[model samples]
Target: MSSGVEADIALDAAVVLSLGMNRVLGRTAGLAGRGAEALAALAAGRAEARAAALAEAESYDQALRQVLERNARIEALAETREKLDAEVALPEPLRPEEQPIEELTAWCAATDQALDGAERRLSERLAAQVAAEIFAVPGGAEGLRADLGAPAPEPTENETYANETYRTLERVLARLLPDATADDRTAVAEAARLLAGIGSPEEAEGVITEVRLRVGEANRRTEELRARERRRAAERDAAEQAEAERQYVLGSITSAFEEMGYEVQDGFETLTAGEEGAVVLSRGSWPDHSVRLRVDDAAQVRAAMVRTAPARSEDDRRLDVEREREWCEAFEAARERLGEAGVRSEVTWRLAPGVRELPVSDGARQTGTRSAQRERSREREK
Candidate 1:
């Protein structure tokens, strides 16, 4: 019984030891499984962290590329803006808040407005200059202000201010030089046309200068023509006055000769060689004797003379001498009569080639003898 109890105890002890060893082995296996699970979990976590880091790095690269592109575009726009500013000769167009497109649009709008305003001003200045030039022409300002009917209306959208001003100036110019030459009119018309279509202020100014020069040349020519016309008129007047004076002188001389009972020739002829202002006179009964009057440039009778034929015999010579004496006395009486009529003359007598000059008398010497002789000769002829 002791042995059996001991054996049972020993069996119980071995069983207990086995049970303890199994328990220990089971616990160790459980610890190893748990450690393997822990290690797998740690590796999975590390792989997830690595994937997250790669995704983050890729996102950062994309973001950096975008920033670089944006910076490049901005720099390009800035360079374009600087070039544009230099080209337009204006201030920097782009503001800090303006994008490239916005700044360009604003600049275009401002530039258009400025150009329009400048064109308008230049057009107005040109119009004024053209009007002034027109007014300077001869008879240009004749009632021009009063004749200008009314002001024109404003221009429409289709019409620019320059065109409107040009039209107005054209109207004024059309009426200005009514007597201008065809060439001058054509030149002015051409200049006006050029000025009307001018775009830039510089172009308009250059055209204005050219037009002014043309106008000046045209005016100079006009003035020259006017001077020529005046000279022609003066010449015509002088010629007329001279002709009138000549007619008056002729009439006076004719009247004086007709009052002396002599048949006077209408015009002067060269009776003697190298003699000027020699007038011949005749009577109805005296065929062999003649009378002459000498005149000066001033239409004044300088001298009067009686001429007789040459004697052929002694009796004829005596008669001729007597006739010459009678003629001298008659000439003296004629001189006295002319002096009373406000015409002073010197008496001369000519017999053959001999001439005798006598002083002018204020009173009659002996008119009865010559008068009786002339009366007898007239009665015999009748």
Candidate 2:
């Protein structure tokens, strides 16, 4: 019974330490365990037995605490690994299966910081791209940056109002630029260059208010000009705008494939009465495989894996299947690349691997279908 009490006291001390409490053996809270051990020693009245019991309790206490501490660390490391796994791909050495808990925790912190920096850089690049699209003329990203001038310094607390006011002015001026005269636009740009040095709201209010008045005047002149231009402009159908937008989107898609080192042939006809929009892309690496992008009237885009040459043997068939699988990966990557280029796309439908039905000779099928469609269109025109 005395030995049992001694063991229980030692276990209780370990429980306390496992809760991350301070070392309890020599402290006030440890008195109960220590007193029990001493009492057991005295009651047994055998020096050898007492020494053995003390050694046993001390060993149990140390072992139990170590186990509990290790368990806690393992639990924490596991949670960190799960979060990192979901956030980004784990590096080779930091992967949980590759190393122990201690090393993973140390490496994950660095990886998390690196991911943060990468995301920030990507965000800046996207912002710059958007700014170029809206503000720059064709091939004018660098010129637009020059026109916008250098970035303003961080505003002090006292200059917050002034800074926000300037930003508002800049946004409104940019929106009005399409209608404003070159001279008026230059005036606004010059004002922006000069105002970049001003910090006080009082000093900026006059220049900002003057810029606003100029923008309002420009808007009034634009309305008047549109009234005259409307009389001279021909009435156009809605399909014209839709076709232009479709062509623009197709151009972006073509650029994305070209950037991927594929040769693009965008024979995109206007989506008039019965036209089918198609683009073909091929790469030298896979001479026999080509990707056909089909855009219908509804503007839904789909990629077909085209086997330019028919398979003559079983080995050729196997190679064709492998090539199709590779095209699936490339098609998905192309969509992602389009997003980076500011073109958003969503997959409406896809046939999974081993489920797709491909024609024996896609090249022949494509040619016949396109020719027949054109012949029908010509008949209709006649």
Identify the candidate with maximal lDDT.
2
Among all candidates shown, the one with the greatest TM-score: 1
Candidate 2 Cα deviation (angstroms), residue 274: 3.9
Superposed by TM-score, candidate 2 places the C-alpha of residue 197 at a distance from the truth, in angstroms, of: 80
Residues 166-234 of candidate 2: C-alpha lDDT, one tens digit per residue: 456545554452434545555555554445555567766776676667667766776676566444332
Q: What's the TM-score of every candidate structure?
A: 0.39, 0.32
RMSD of each: 62.9, 29.9
Error of 2 at 117 (Å): 62
Off by over 4 Å in 2: 1-237, 268-275, 360-382
How big is the positional error of residue 101 in model 1, measured in Å on the Cα after superposition? 84
Residue pairs whose backbone atoms clash in candidate 2 = none
